[model samples]
Target: MANPGGGTVCNGKLHNHKKQSNGLQSRNCTKNGIVKEAQQNGKTHFYDKLIVESFEEAPLHVMVFTYMGYGIGTLFGYLRDFLRNWGIEKCNAAVERKEQRDFVPLYQDFENFYTRNLYMRIRDNWNRPICSAPGPLFDVMERVSDDYNWTFRFTGRVIKDVINMGSYNFLGLAAKYDESMRTIKDVLEVYGTGVSSTRHEMGTLDKHKELEDLVAKFLNVEAAMVFGMGFATNSMNIPALVGKGCLILSDELNHTSLVLGARLSGATIRIFKHNNTQSLEKLLRDAVIYGQPRTRRAWKKILILVEGVYSMEGSIVHLPQIIALKKKYKAYLYMDEAHSIGAVGPTGRGVTEFFGLDPHEVDVLMGTFTKSFGAAGGYIAGRKVREGPLVSV
Candidate 1:
């Protein structure tokens, strides 16, 4: 290429015009420190690059792609700046729209879920809400939005749900068909779901005694007695059996029912390490030595209380070691088989059966049927050293 005045000649042509990706040209400008713009007043001029001088300098596709990329970059940059000023750059309408598409509408599909649920909540006293309020705020609702979380219209759903953790049905009795239910139904028909009175105060019905008989048969014991609940069985019997002056050696791992009952007995309570024969013997030996010298009062009726199975750890007690220790120290023993009754031992006689020990080895065997049998009461099975124990079960 040559300049017009024959000043020089070169293969490359000098471009007279330069264009930006936007197809806008830069105003007449400088290239190599040559002045491109003149100042006017106090303002400086900035000009955009526009159309290029030569189209043959680059391939058509390459040129078009570069221009398109530049145009798109400018467009997005403007949009971003615009949105940032409006404080909406971070919000995505597309994302919110996608989320809205995935919801289960509360009103459209789940009706009657309203009244039954609200009534049930009030009936159950779930939150312990106030009972004295005027009714039907729903009569004035144009739409639903509350001054608080929920409007006065409906006692809005406050709590999500209740999970059943304390049902305590260990044997899954509720799920069984045929035999257990049939037995329960037959028994219920004969003796009502519950007795109308207490045992000492006319609460004890014939069915109550019958159940006790059934329990004794189950535990293979001479006698058994039932209480309204598993907790009551121990609560009442413990104080009656052990007087205020007696010494009771209890295991540290014994249940709260045993703890409360023993406390109520007003007995001298001594606790040994859980299931440790050595620990129990130490206490028993002390009682025997101290009880005799201090008073000639039958040398203290020493009662040893323990659980047949530890519920938390699912550990079984060594009945042989305990029974042997009881005999060695002339102590009467009580065993609570709450978690063991129907699970341990060969014939389901609990720890006694598990150890090949006779039922007579335990002075009193107490436990609940709400666990293994899937039924709802607790019983104490025992044999008398002097008189034969009678069972109403």
Candidate 2:
């Protein structure tokens, strides 16, 4: 739901201020004569204020509101078999290479349709077709080059005339373009093209630290972590953060990698209707109402996950609003800006820069370097630190 506040910090617990005559639970934060209400659904409430302080120490207290501890340990996968089965069926339904066919049977009788009936309808034999040659089209780029020509030597080869476009270079860091080519070449000449062993064995190089430092400085975060591709960063971190009794809140359209990671974490998965903040709040409120009857392990830590820019829609996430919800509900927030950096924001600083949020404002920031930076690989920027190199040998 839209934030009703005119832009100010709103604080309060989730409360239905109309008086709990229905035996349903609710809490409204009231301070200085201002009140924030929790709708009857009891999902989430909009605080009139931004959270200047995070209640990291009071996770259990927040769980108290979720009295069966409804969502304490909910994970993402296989929780609802109907959904999982449906997804599996859909995935399996894809036409396999062997069974799929694109050829259409040729119809001899249809030959009359193309040449006789259709061609005759538009035939004009005597009329002269207009063909006037136009002079070479040119652009007026003032003071750009010494030759003042619109293009380089006209390159028109039958096999190689057009610009090469099929390079899998995402970060624009291809050897054909980036200066890193020469730097890497020199390094390879001195250190050899390949490291003989894993990082622990002997693959370690000073260049690794140099690249890591650059990433750390660019992100301006406390620590930066890198990992092997295809293995996925979510799998590496999610399981470690939540353990057995944790809940992962996934948007309806979250990428499959995250869905899989959350499942593998062995945590309970509770899906909030996609981008429905109100629904998320209701689920959390339900958790609070349910958790009140339990203690400790009965409750689950909550984490909200979303993408900074959805690939299908090219729509950007509203980070400020999401941050607000996280504060009121006391949930951790994780955002994947894989498609956002170097493309959306004015200065191309990714979602945070687009929204003007502080780096520490988000719990974790993840993005790939393929698009805007025009290179390969991805990066994870967060406050958490781990000893030794993050990549596996």
Candidate 3:
């Protein structure tokens, strides 16, 4: 028998563990592993069956200290800059030539100040060079920075067996697999690294076709299109889907790639609160009633952009509710499952499968192979579109 939240019921009563600092609560049977539960909308969701976790904010003290630190840093940074400009100290970044000084700055003052003063101080913690594949355990090189993380040099020492806590190797596919490595080598011998042309100009290969077919089959969709780069899958294709006179309702915390794509699409973009159905509904209602601004003409199309699992927040999308809302407002839905694909769901088919929702309900299903598959590229899947009269129904 199973508990109401879908955990296995033990003969003994479940014992509650102390609450975690990150706001996770667990109840476990004596024999089984810890099972975390989150309560929302009067429903208990167990993480044992679903990988999604409730969004938790940092503790008040943590936020307070973080802001204080930044404020102090900014204050000192401005003071130093002021001193340099007033000749009290040397201005190391000052340009020496008139032509160079007159040339338009590559970055705005705020951006340049941020990189030089703020980011440079804490850059040591980011972009560490790894010596091994990003598996469960890997090696990272040791380095030292003499100028407060502005530059670093190797110390000829390695931190081996370091736990890789950050990489998106969700299924451990980054580790060497015998058959997969052999197949990859075989394909490399034939494909020769990369095609020197775009798909339309001769880049298309038999493997591309095979991969698209497999993606479509796996997604249970009518057809699929493959792209070489995952970021391009969103940044490039969004423009093809909608343009000026169209309206895009996007989550406020969506990935930067999606934001870029929406801007490039020339669509009127309105951001709704992240994972908030009420906010989304309000936006949709306003869009319908107002129509296009000034002209008051109906929009050519309306697209709702959301992610299956938001990468940074680790909060799963409320798909069922969003689908219902999409239908209510007659809006097309585009789901980016970049982080959720192969990491969630009963069979790892992604959020659609996780929620037992029909794939056809979503107009566009976009995902990347880089995360769980430990591979490169991305795909877009949806109902098959015929060239002419016979579009898939």
Which 10 consecutive residues of model 2 have the lowest summed lDDT? 126-135
The superposed Cα distance between candidate 3 and the true structure at residue 309, in angstroms, equals 0.4
The CA lDDT at 189 in model 1 is 90
Q: What is candidate 3's local distance difference test score?
A: 0.79
**Which sequence of candidate numbers ranks them by TM-score, best first?**
3, 1, 2
lDDT of 2: 0.56
When summed lDDT is taken over every stretch of 10 residues in candidate 3, the lowest stretch is 9-18
Model 3 residue 228 CA deviation (Å) reads 1.5
Per-residue CA lDDT of candidate 2, range 156-189, in tens?
3222122333323334444343466677678879
How far off is model 3, as Cα RMSD? 10.4
Best by TM-score: 3
lDDT of 2 at 305: 81
What are the per-residue Cα lDDT tens digits for candidate 1 across 61-152? 99899889767655655575468549986422112245675776435422433332233223332223322211211122122224321223
